[model samples]
Target: MLAPKRSWIQQVVYLIGMYGQFLKVYVKTLVEYRADTLIAVIAGIVAQGSTLIFLTVIFNRIPTLAGWDFYELVFMFGLAATGRALNQTFFNAPFLLTGYIRNGRMDMMMVRPVGVLFQAIGYSQELNGVGQLITGFAIMGYSASHLDMAWTFLSVLYVGIALLCSAFIQFSILLTISVLTFWIQEVRSLIYPITWLYDFTRYPLQIFHPLLRGLLTYIIPYSLASFYPAAYLLRPEQYGWAVWGVPAAAMVIVMMAYFIWSQGLKRYSSVAG
Candidate 1:
């Protein structure tokens, strides 16, 4: 039988505890295979740098995108990078659900005392976060130097909170996509579209039409993962709304994601169970 549903705060604490345990195992596993880990880390950093460079090239040709200047765009990109990194580090393994199910790993997890979803997402160091950290901070620095902002202590704290919410959104979206494994049986085909959302993230919602942009900002809100945070970081005076909206939206999205994942879990059929 499944564990009884707990209070929201308890659920979060449980998940965090699971993540800590899994991260420890992940690090130990990587330490055993140090050479492969080093190679993978380096390759990941190079790939991240290439992506940032491509963004720079695009901005060089087009001065401003949807009224968002270059540095602002870069800031959004940085936020995107950081969010993606966190998602990959923590929740990306959910994408492996179908394969695990097909191969009987789901049965193994079911026998464990911890929650299945927690065990799945937090199973592995993501070995790649280090590289993403480097490239993401580099992108942030580039934007910080070019963009004008009064960085007070409060502002920095707000920005940090915004970034964390962005990461939460990123994790939620990936979980939704990955949960399809219960039906699709294979998800490699979906990776590109989910990753493409990162491209859409680098600009303001205004680049699209008013209706489309509005829908994106509210309904789907993937772009908001970065653009909203950048709005606060770049033009905090004009977009004071983010001071409230960012966390509120993140809370809503995370709740929605949790609900969806629970339904997906109910739908999952264990070959062994």
Candidate 2:
């Protein structure tokens, strides 16, 4: 006779436990490769640092960019960085999907009992993201000290929700790109240009031309992750509605990406075969 089927709750619990185990292995790997992990973290910090340097140089010349003060822009950058760190830390495995597809690893994953997407998501944990998280929070804290912002309980709660939504949006986009590999089998070229568009989100959307702003807001929606949330926190009266919209956009994008992934999985003809 067959074994009993797990309930949805039991399945979720099992996945969570499995994910925790994967995370422990990742931690162990990081510990074993201390220098490599440190270098990776430093590279992340330096990349963000370069942006900070650019911001400093630009702010020195001008009081504000598109009506946003230096601190305001920094706050937005920090928000973006934090969201990106969350994505890199938890959902970066999509970047490695090409290899999995090429090297017959996808075959192994397909034969496993777990959901493929869950396995893909938990495949890697990036230690480098820790550096981005450090800088993101530090910059946000420093900027908040300079800005005249209120830190009410509601405001803090909203910030947490916004960050989670932002990470979800980013992960959905990456997952969608990875899904394309299921069809075309090579999409690294497509991923970079698309993902690089997120840099536009580090500053105020008001500075960009109407067309670019529309692209960022609607098509890519990176601005929702960085600018809208920062704007809402900085000036709630002006951008209060975004608190609702961010989560809505995240949910929609994630559902859409998951649908595409499901379809792609069905269409997938394993490279091994």
Q: For each candidate, what TM-score against the reference?
A: 0.83, 0.95
Q: Return the clash pairs for model 1, or none.
A: none
Query: 49, model 2: CA deviation in Å?
Result: 2.0
Give the poorly placed runs of model 2, Cα more than 4 Å off.
1-4
Tens digits of per-residue lDDT, candidate 2, 65-152, equal: 9889999998899999998888888888778888888888888888888878888888867788877877887888888899999999
Candidate 2 lands at a TM-score of 0.95
Model 1's TM-score against the true structure? 0.83
Off by over 4 Å in 1: 1-18, 29-32, 55-63, 210-215
Clashing pairs counted in every model = 0, 0
